[model samples]
Target: MLRSTGKHSFTKSTVIFSLVCLLGIALTVDVFWATRSSSSSSVYSSIASNWPREESHVVVLPKAANDTDSEETVDDKANRVPQRLLSATFADIPAPELEWEQMPSAPVPRLDGSAVQIKDLLYVFSGYGTLDYVHSHVDIYNFTDNTWSGRLEAPKDMANSHLGVATDGRYVYVVAGQSGPQCRTPPTSNTFVLDTETEKWERFAPLPAPRYAPATQIWKGRLHVMGGSKENRHTPGTDHWSIAVKDGKAIEKEWRNETPVPRGGPHRACVAVGDELYVIGGQEGDFMPKPGSPNYKCSRRNEVVYGDVYMLDSEMKWTVLAPMPKPNSHIECSWFLWNNSIIIMGGTTEKHPVNKRMILVGEVFRFQLDTKQWSVIGRLPYRVKTTLAAFWDGWMYFTSGQRDRGPDNPQPKKVVREMWRTKLKL
Candidate 1:
């Protein structure tokens, strides 16, 4: 009878242990299933909610008609609808309200040049053409007639690329750019002045340092050139120089050195509004140490591009502005002072393979000079780099840029002859 009791007790203990183990296993499975379901549901919800909204915002170009009759019809109403849509969107945005309208192309394909609007006419000068050669011809486009005409050639030895251009009401100054052989050594120090009134080009005082890709702006009636690569193609400098223009010539006074940029690199784009100058987007290096000494081998160090924005105040103080959304290099950024806000536009992001991965942004951002806040504007018609932009009569004209291919085989080909005039609602 005692042995029977002991066996029953052992069976009872075994049953209780099995029940506990089963309960724990069930709880574990329930927790895991709950977690996985919650995670997947959240992901799907986010993706579904986000995707359509983005798609809706995209502006699709109207389809081109192939037949002559269709072409004529489309041309009559081609950009009319797009302009209306853009105008409606701008009504909601506050100061510097804007609209975009496509314009006819210049006479020839050009990029990496300088453009200035004098009176009702826009002049583009000295840029890289479809071929590798630097262009000397000046092209004039009249907004009144909606026609384009080629003008006199730039002065001999004045043909250049990557030059800094600024207009002081009468003439456009082309300063310090690359002229000789492709992808070769140092660029030229030659500076050329284009007289908009005369349709003639003349030489100016040479820069102390021969540089390319320098940031330039007209401040207080003086032209300033800052932060460009010198000697070593990859090594950019922090030097700053200024030339005061008087009677249509750059004064012979020595370049006054200003405060060096904390982080020095190439200055790809710049804009001057009022008394402030904003410089944006370039690369910084990190040198590797050479063997045996503290000296370093000149390889492309950090090789990192930036979206950093720097503003030089009227008092010549440098202040950091809000950074760009992403890293970009070799941009052609400028500020269009509309109402009280400045509109920034037309720049390239970091280099990537193909046109897809590597994006050329047409998105315009408005920077309120007083508030220091950035707001998004309408996008551009297409991708462009090293383009020239000018603001006139409440419209922004963007012209002459190279269309990027891809990274696997990047080509500096694809020159654009198209011109786009985006009217602002300010």
Candidate 2:
């Protein structure tokens, strides 16, 4: 009788365990089916919400002037003047189709430095400064965080000003600039490569010639250096050189000399957009008095400055474009390919004195590459010179430059620890 009772209990326990397992399986099936049924619809809703949807498109029409003024005012007569009319062609557009915002300032003041964007961060390096009384420091600003941070200093005794910086998506190539004991000395052809991922600096092949104020741009997987000073402070060279990379190292190629710049001058700025490189205005060679000439003792003729613009194609051919309305030198300007136009801003005009007067130009201009025409966009809010400018995320950024004082005070000044951004609109 006891053995019979034990067998009966064991059979009942087995039946209960089997029932529990079956219930779990049924619940899992119900959950899986429910999830599978909703997955496609959920995905579709997410994509639809994110898709760009056009709102009302309104057409803008110009408004006519009020008829209250029967006769034109004196200002109207002034506008009618031939010279004034020509100047009116460059009139300031009251509103920029673009928007602007202020960003965090650099850790320190800088001018004549190099700025290159890697991903979302703008890395600023080796500018002339008064920190520790003239320094070579590297600082970086992140667009995502809108903050500034210091990075590795330029590699091994690398002090530079107005150097050319270019990048190939992974590594930043620092070309020649003014370095060494004298601030005006041409930079050693020494090339420095900064790896963005590792935050490391490596020295590469030296440039063919000691160059300063040279413009650097990357094209067809090679870095191009063009139009800079060669040793002499006053002399500018049109020689162009390129460097090819292999397996994360820079291999200096033969210096491929191109057509010398037609209007050869110093401090000319260049930028690469699409397949073309545009070279802008700079100061010409200094004018030395001729021997036995009158006014040799008292008068020194200034070198002719250029406001002319030129474009270099992939074939090494150059074509001149519309000239800048005002000739400028020692100006910190930036170039960007925006909405089918090449926009330029900042830089000091020849009419403004760099030492005594700080002409902070807020005026923005755009060059329609297709039409060879220039039009004013808007003015910058602040006055700055010798600052570094760069573009990222549809905004133009200006960082660290010199401020001009009135003629009474001629001492060199600093405009560090400030940053500004202007957004481009279509």
Candidate 3:
């Protein structure tokens, strides 16, 4: 069964209540100090008490005759001096319209596949099938022809979901992923590279350790792979490594293993901007008490959603940035680079009644590198999970995934074959 990585069982109400209590105590102390001090005492004393008090050094300024003779009008009391308005001709121009355009569907309907764009074609790799079939089929879609075609099947050894696929504009690289049909399977280190020009596949050096659902990116001339499932789906591993590449081949140098992350999780979306790589939100194990444990009342070992974001630069330095505004986890969402800003669109999370269904949202978020802030930009046309997003020229394309809504039933629907494109407002 498909499960969401976004569910959390522990309550944060206790922590919130403690913070409120602290604020209340701070307010009470401020009030006591203000009333007790002479310099800060209340100024609203009765007129009778102030009148003719010989011991007090009080001087009242006389009010203007116009002010005392008539009460101020409501407009006069509320008005402020007007400031000069700045004018610009651009304000007359209408805002750009954003809409989705349907494109040619894939040859076969699949979910959780890896989509990579090279020039005018989009190559989709192996994915999980609607009826529990794991695929090795490779499909290619050409934008110029508005048609779909079949490519050679991915190598038998490298066929699976959770695979890390990336391209260097010439060659495509496939990395580790789960090798079975089950949600929780033994992750493999089988790796390969396909020559886009020759239409042939060749084996490449495997990962240092097994990983599934890892985030992969080709920055500069190297392939950087980080964070994923190891022994089991819940067991997130922290290992990160990069393989040096030159002239469409893995360099002879050994794969460099970097410092491990503080915490690791599966299906985290990562993207590369210039020399830096960003590891965005994903799922991690909640280290709470078990059901039968001593502190079991507060414990639910559910999967925890994360807004934890970390960045790694060229010098091999890692820095944690301001997190996403909300928890982002579970579904394999796409992270895109457009006009120097990062855009994350469409992913899923689980809502509770404990075993009912998944909650999917089409929300969009943008991360600004200069200010280290994230803002909600907009949303997708529909709710999607495990969808793929690509950018070409000025248009953004999103394709092929399950459109889950409300509750999941025994007989699930087929995977979507629709592809949607939009001209992004940069």
Which candidate comes out best when scored by TM-score?
A: 3
In the range 137-246, model 2's lDDT, one tens digit per residue, is 67888877788865777776565676777777778878777663234343577778888888888877777787767767777666778776666555767777776775
List runs of model 1 lying over 4 Å from the truth: 1-101, 284-303, 333-335, 353-358, 404-413
Question: Clash pairs of candidate 3?
Answer: none
Deviation (Å) of 196 in candidate 3 = 1.0
TM-score on alpha carbons, each prediction = 0.67, 0.67, 0.69
Sorting all predicted structures by TM-score, with the top scorer first, yields: 3, 1, 2
lDDT per residue for candidate 1 within 210-258, as digits (tens), equals 8776777778867788776665556777888886777568675666677
Worst 10 residues of 2 by lDDT: 83-92
Residue 205 of model 1, lDDT score: 82
RMSD score of candidate 1 (Å): 13.8
Clashing pairs in 1: 97-425, 286-302, 353-407, 354-406, 354-407
**Clash count, predicted structure 1:** 5
Model 3 whole-model lDDT (C-alpha atoms) = 0.68
Mind sharing the TM-score for model 1? 0.67
Question: After superposing candidate 2, which stretches have Cα over 4 Å from the reference?
Answer: 1-100, 180-182, 246-248, 251-253, 286-303, 331-333, 352-360, 406-413
Per-candidate RMSD, Å: 13.8, 29.4, 22.9
User: How do all the candidates rank in terms of lDDT, highest first?
Assistant: 3, 1, 2
Candidate 3 residues lying further than 4 Å off, grouped into runs, are 1-98, 285-301, 330-333, 353-356, 406-414
